[model samples]
Target: MQNLQGKSIAILATNGFEQSELEVPRDKLRGAGATVHVISLEPGRIKGWDKDDWGNPVDVDRTLDSVSADDYDAIVLPGGQINPDLLRVEQKALDFISKFWSDNKTVAAICHAPWLLVETGIAKGRKMTSYPSVKTDVINAGAHWQDSPVVTDQGLVTSRNPGDLDAFCEKIAEEIKEGRHERRAA
Candidate 1:
């Protein structure tokens, strides 16, 4: 496994996040020596969406209002239609993401999570993947959409769905280790 002992990963989401998408990656990253911060639109706990119904609650470590991009090494956006949709509307969440790219930090978004990327207008000209239905919106936003389980572009890594968890988790940690690959002058 790649070393991430000193890295901090920020996961942005809200109520209705997919159970596995959020928990699985968080645990795996934590086990690999990264401090995973669960950031949400609010404090306390965020609800998990399991199958078609709601499930367990995960505590929120930081609110969108309090997250500082420079405090963390990378940002993760877990997917479920509801979570990403809600996050995209919060200017602070979107701005935090923009700062990730501006500083060449990694940003990983899976399943429906890329919706927030579309909201930031940076998906343009990049290659990525997501749940099939979101393909249209991604393309409309000017990205090259793929059918792969995971696709990483310009430090942004995206996965298709929960079925791709192994590939998803591996890539996330890799990107976290790949860490802050500096962008070239355009």
Candidate 2:
């Protein structure tokens, strides 16, 4: 694992997030020595969705309005059907994600979280992957969708689903270490 000391990473999520999708990366990144913050739409804790039911609550490190893209080296979006569905419709969420892409910072999304990429207009022309059900949406947004554990274009990293968590988290650390990329703005 890379030594991520001094690196700051933001895990943007909210209630209904896939439990493992959010927990795994947050734990992995923090274990690698990066400061990980769980930023939600509101303060306090947010509940997660497990395979079929509600999961444990994760404490919120900060609310979306309280943080800026400039404070972190990378941003991660954890996917759950409900999580992305809710976030994609929030203009605030969309704009926050767009800022990361526009700044060329590492923008990582796993599973259905890629929906945010499409909404933020950053999926166009990028080779990425997401949950099987999100394939059509990604393609419609002009992305070259692939059926792989993980795919990366520029600083954007994506994974198919929970099965790809290992690769997803590893790639996130790698991308953060690579620093900002020189890519077309969203």
Candidate 3:
């Protein structure tokens, strides 16, 4: 595991996030020595969406109203069809995501989570991958979408689905270790 002792990471999600997508990466990042916090739209806990049903609940460590992108070293967006769809409409969420890019902090998304990336307007000109269903949206956002388990462009890391968690987590840690990237202009 990479040494991320002094690093801090934020897992951004809301109700309906894919259970595995959020839990797995959160565990892996914490195990790797980074301080991981779950930031949500509300206080208390948010429920997750499992394979075909509602999954477990994860406690929210902070609310968007109380925190900014400057609070962490990196941010992770976990995908579930409903989660990203809901998040993409919020200007606050989009602005928070934009701050990560503007600051060059690592921003990692997996599965349908890249939908939020498209809404943030940072997908343009970057190489990324997401659940097959999101390929067209990503391309439309000007990203070079690829069919792969995982793809990393600068500090932005993306993966296709839950099966890609291992590679996704690894790339996120690697990118965080390397620190901020000088993103190319959109």
Candidate 4:
């Protein structure tokens, strides 16, 4: 209904992801007519964390090693402390994100997922929002960090946490529809 038909949306996540953060957006984006694919560190499936405990399982669409930046219109990074913290340490995962930025494609990260953006070093000067705990890292990265449900600047979209999934998913859908390229990437 929101004109996202046929758009390919990719979610890059790993084990220990916040379940709601991943599920909410995945469902919302799919409902908006985008094909949502979950790309994880491994093939098969990845487990999610819900409120300090293990949650449901989500089947993986592709492994990070097999995914190419050009295959999808947008990339969503769902964060939990362990998810992004672990991903940030993987050069391949961080490199995959930078590829999206360099291509000026839509890249959205929620919660601690913004940590990947910091590691990518492509958010400098772009207005962003992330879980409050990472505000300092965002600021030090030269990005304007804010306290909000969602923040979209250029081709980058960010949200504070799972609580902001409504706004987060909506903004990501709109960004894909708008086709706004990242200015810094250009």
- Candidate number of the best TM-score: 3
Per-residue lDDT over 1-186 for candidate 2, one digit per residue giving the tens place of the 0 to 100 score? 688999999999989999999999999999999999999999999999998999999999999999998899999999999998999998888888898888889999999999999988899999999999999999999999999999989999999999989999999889889989999643
**Per-residue lDDT of 4-58 in model 4, one digit per residue for the tens?**
8989988999999999999998998898888889998888889999978999999
| Candidate 1 residue lDDT tens string, 48-166 | 99989998999999987887999998888899988998888888889999999888989889999989889998688889999998999999999899999999886889999999988
lDDT (0-100) at residue 157 of candidate 1?
90
Model 4, residue 127: C-alpha shift (Å): 0.5
Given candidate 2, what's the lDDT at residue 2? 89
Go through the candidates in order and give each one's C-alpha lDDT.
Answer: 0.88, 0.93, 0.94, 0.89
Q: Which candidate is the best by lDDT?
A: 3
* Greater-lDDT candidate between 1 and 2: 2
Clashing pairs in 2: none
Q: Give the lowest summed-lDDT range of ten residues in model 1.
A: 177-186
Give lDDT: candidate 1, residue 37: 95
How far residue 101's Cα lies from its native spot in candidate 2, in Å, is 0.8
lDDT of 2 at 92: 84
State the lDDT of candidate 3 residue by residue for 1-186, as single tens digits: 688898999999999999999999999999999999999999999999999999999999999889989989999999999999999998889999999989999999999999999999889999999999999999999999999999999999999999989989999999999988987675
lDDT of 4 at 119: 92
